[model samples]
Target chain A: MILKVENLNKSFGGILASRNLDLQVEEHEVHAIVGPNGGGKTTLMAQLSGLSKPDSGKILFKDRNITPLSTHKRVHIGLASSFQITSIIQSMTMLDNILLAVQSLQGHSYKFWAPVSGDAGMRETALNVLENVGLGRQADTVAGKSSHGEQRQLEIAMALALEPDLLLLDEPTSGMSKEESGEMVRLLKKMKGEKTILLIEHDLDAVFALADTTSVLVDGRILATGTAEQIRSNPKVQQAYLGEETA
Target chain B: MFKFLENLPARVYLAVTALLAVAPLLVTLGSQPFYLDLLTRILILAIAAVSLNLIIGFGGMISLGHAAFIGIGAYCVGIPAHYDIFNGFIHLGLAISCSAAFALITGAISLRTHGLYFIMITLAFAQMLYFTFVSLDEYGADDGLIIYQRSDFNGLLNLENPTTLYYTVLVTLLGLLYLMHRLVHARFGRVIIGCKHNEKRMQALGFDTYRYKLTCYVISGTICGIAGFFLGNFTNFISPEMMDWTHSGELIFMIVIGGTAGIFGPVVGTAFFLLLEEMLSGLTQYWQLIFGLVLILLVVFGKGGVHGLLVWADTRQTAQAQPENDS
Candidate 1:
């Protein structure tokens, strides 16, 4: 397994965000976590990404416990996440955004005298990452001026630049239009076998299309885990989530 | 040459540097020695503003206690000079180290808070330093201290000469401006700018942003401290008043007036502020009241200050010229 979560628990004030949440993601498999609104999908992603601490649980990445690691430290050890609400440096160019991720993985960024733009190798690497996300043509476009769909692509490009072992993508197509969503699915479909992605997605079509394994989360607990066929047939998952949508 | 001149801000920068180079000669020819002193003072404060811009303008760190470094730097010179130590190197070393140390310690705590709280905590630290300096009666306290002789460079350069001092200050400013240019384009600079735009995103991108910001804060303080070293030599006076929050506010005003986006903006802002202060104070005692109104109008209508106006004009010219080229 690339990732293992054991009985993870988190509560905010009086509400429980995660309760005895257990999950496992296999190497090079696209694992999708699907649920209704506020079903603790993001909370589980947050805990796994080291953005928040679980009150009672252990998170193991590559079989080593990473429950107490900070967000940046987890990233350094090959775990990178993309936010649900699309977090990117708006004032910089799309290429520059990816360059930041590339720079981070290369070495310490205490280099003050030499200009980063002059580093031809780093620029090429960043460009290649952008190209992989189909944003090579818009490399010079300021991120804030880019279309929402383009920004989402840039966001994934940034996370991919880290070359992480496991990618935690939270609702990558949340704010995208139908065409944009199709483009995103195609992009992810290309990376399906090569990358281990723990995806939290709302789009059922996307989940069925991309996910190698699907897990149903309900009220901060895993209701069921199976293939698309089994998940669609599972009575518990259908009653808790899929049934609500279909009905 | 014409193509180079097409860039308005670059042209202005070149013209300003050339004028400053000949300013001392001009003052001598006009027999107005007072203008030399005024220009020297402006150059010194411009250095401070430029340093502050590293954090405020570029790094998105709005520190309200930047003048504290100036005060600390001045004291580094004053305290040693009091005991008959005239070594320029020693004074500079102390100034840089002391200011850097102070910034590191304060920044460690202050950077943990964001926005208004960060501003408040920084102000509180400066006030703390101000009071500490005021209570030190051994170093003249609230009354201040004086240096009988300028820092001795052992005949390398003469601070005793007004013209020499002006050139020295000018060289320092130019060197710093070049350094700032190099810095903002470097890896370190990109990280700082990224943090400014979105700290959380930067963190997610595997950057330990707090450490980068703290390092930037220290760099800004150290540069400002160097400016303070020059200020002590020029004014020949060191006092707690030098670090008053109002003085820090004035530094911010200078940066805002010139423009914050460009590396040279603070220098232009400093010049505008001092020259306007000089002209208006000569006209009336209520110069500050008029200054207040002008600043209010500038902030309200002029979004980018003087530098922004220059950029706007440059872009317009480029747009107008584009059609001619196409035709």
Candidate 2:
């Protein structure tokens, strides 16, 4: 397994966000977690991303325990994530935003004397990543000016810039139109095997279309974990979490 | 043609600066001693304004107690010069070191809070410094201090001569502006602005935003301290009133009038403000009332100050040209 969570538990004052939550994601696997509104999906994702620490648990990545690491350290260790609410530098161009992220990952190659505009290698790599998300035409446009769907794609491209071994996306399709959601699903499908992906999402259609394995989470506990077919047919998962029609 | 102007050589900027540096010497249309003195004062204030812009414009830090840093710097020079410790370089060095130390200490505490709270704490600390300076009877308590003469430099520059003094301030201001330009474009500058916009995002991206903010505060204080040194030399006097809260307001006002986006905005604004004071004072003794009204107008209409107005014009011009490209 590329990521292993052993008995993670987190509580806030009197509220339990997660209780004995255990999950494992193998290399190159697309793991999907579906849960109800108050089902602690974001809390689990935050813990994994190192944004918030688990009250008690061991999170192991590549056989190394990272329970005590910081968010940036987690990023340096080949783990990257996209925010649920868009986090972008509004004044800078989309390309510049992605280029900064790429620069961070590329072994301290920041040269203050040379203008980034004329650097062909950096520009070309940024262009390729922009093209991957169909934002090639909007590369020079400020990140703030782009449509919401395009902004979401820019967020993913930012994550891709890190060239992480695993990518964690929290609600990549939230607040997107039906067509935009479909495009996001298609994009994620293309991203499979290029890197390990752990997704927290609610849009069942996209999840069913993209996930190889599905886990049901309810009230901070994992209900079941199985192949997509098994998850689709599980009665307890249908009645308790994923409505009968969706199952 | 537009693209050529947009990518104009840095030499053009350097040339303008060079001309400004030598303007007083080259032009002797009116060689009034008072005019020279007034111009020197404007130059000193311009330096202070520019340093404040480093924090206010580029770093997005709203410092209301900036004048206190200027006060610390002036006293650093005045107290030593008063006591006959007349080494010019050492006085300047002491001034800068004192201001930087103050910034480091206050910034550590003030930066822990955000937004309005940050502004308030900084203002409060500056007031504390102001009162402390006022209580020092040796420096003249609330009355202020007078320098019998400018510092005696060892075989270098004599500040007693008006022309020599003007050039001295001119060189220092130009050096600071150049440094500020280079700083804002560097990697550290980008991170500073990035943190200003979205600190949480910068942290998520693995940058320690607090350190960047504290460093900016120190740099701003140090630069303001330089201005304070010039201020003392220009007036040949220093006082507890130098660190007054109203003086801080004026420093902020200079940045606002100049527009905070570009380096030279503060210089332009300072020149314009002092000129207005000169022209208006000639008209009436009650010139401050008119100055206040004009400031209000500038704030209301010129949202980005004078420089911001220029940027708005440029942005509109670019937006207008977009249709031509589309065609």
Candidate 3:
């Protein structure tokens, strides 16, 4: 197993966002969590990525617990995540944004005399990451000027800059068109075997198509866990999904 | 050739700075005293404005108390000179240390607050310093003190000669500007700008953003310390008014009039401001009203100050002619 979560709990005031959740992810496998509205999928992903603190839980990465670490520390330690909303530095060039993400992973970004953009290695690595996410052509363009779909791709490119062991993508295709969603699915399919992906998505078709193992979450608890077919036929999932049949 | 000029903005600034250094030699090859004094004053203001740029333009930390650093630096020289402790190097060192220490303390407290609160806290601290200076009767108090002579350099460099002092101030300004340029493009600069652009994202990226901001604040103050040393020499006098709130406002106005983020903005703004003051005062006794009106007009109609206006006009012309090539 590459990641393990035991008895994870998060609450806001009196309402529980995540409750006694348990999960384990294997290396190099595409695992996904599917949930209905306000099902706490995002809360769990936030905790796993160190964006939110769990009230009481043990989060183990590579068999070492990392409940005490910050988001950037977790990123430095080979865990990276993208937001459900497209988050990027809009005023900077697409390449600069990737370069910043890569810089975070490298040694001592506080170096005074060395010019960051002038470094061949940093530039080459940034370009490579941009290319991997198919935004290489737009590297010189300001990120704010890019199309929405392109920005989403740039988000993935930024996540790739860390060379993370696991990529956590939340609603990667939230507002995307059907064709764009298909493109994202294809991109994930191409990356499936090479990286361990944990996708939190709302689009059932994309989730079923990309996820090898699907876990259904409803009301801050695990409703079921199995292959897509097993989840599709499960009675609780049927009720939670509002009897709206899906692939 | 094109690649070199791709960084044209920074290059032009360097060229301008180089010319400013040699201006006295070229214009007053006779080595006249009056022209030398004019050049020295310009260079001093340039140093102060440059420091202001580091915090306001780059770090996005608006400090309305910038002149307080100048006052701190000036008083460091003036107070020591008043007591007959007239070592130039010691005075400069004291100025740098005192200004930086004050900046660190004020910055640590103020940086925890954002926007208007930060501005008010910094202004309030400067006022406190101003009041303290006013109450110190032994050093001339409200009347201010005079430095009978410029700093003596232990028999190596004489600061009394107008031309030599002018050149020294110019060179120091140029060196400090170079340091600032290098700092802005460094890893520390990137983090500073990154924080300014998006504080939350930088925090999420695990940057101790407050430390970086406070560090910048101190660096800016230290640079202005050099400016203050020049200032006391320039006027041959110092007063509590050096730390006054209006002087602080003028420092910001210089940056605004020149264009905040532009490298050469401070030089242009300072020159324009000082020259206008000289010309306007000569024209009438109540020239402040005219100056105030002109400032209002400039702010209302000219969003980018003079340099920004020039750039905007140039880009607009080119954009109209070559729409496809422009963004």
On DockQ, the leading prediction is 1
Give the per-residue Cα lDDT of candidate 2 at A196.
Answer: 93
Deviating ranges (above 4 Å) for candidate 1: B1-6
Interface RMSD, all candidates in order, equals: 0.6, 2.8, 2.0
Residue-level lDDT of model 2, residues B246-321, one tens digit each, is 8888888888888887888888788778888889989998988998999899989888777777677767877888
Sorted by DockQ (best first), the order is: 1, 3, 2
The number of the candidate with the highest lDDT is 1
- The better candidate by lDDT, 1 or 2, is 1
Worst 10 residues of 2 chain B by lDDT: B4-13
Estimate every model's Cα lDDT from 0 to 1: 0.94, 0.84, 0.84
TM-score of chain B of each: 0.98, 0.91, 0.91
Question: Clashes in each model (backbone N, CA, C under 3 Å)?
Answer: 0, 0, 0
What docking grade does candidate 3 earn?
acceptable
> What residue pairs are clashing in model 2?
none
Superposed model 3: Cα runs more than 4 Å off: A242-247, B1-19, B22-39, B137-141, B203-206, B313-327
Error of 1 at A194 (Å): 0.2
Record all residue pairs in model 1 with backbone atoms less than 3 Å apart, i.e. clashing: none
Among all windows of 10 consecutive residues in model 2 chain A, the one with the lowest summed lDDT is A107-116
- The global Cα lDDT (0 to 1) of model 1 is 0.94
RMSD of 3: 3.5
Report the candidate with higher TM-score, 1 versus 2.
1
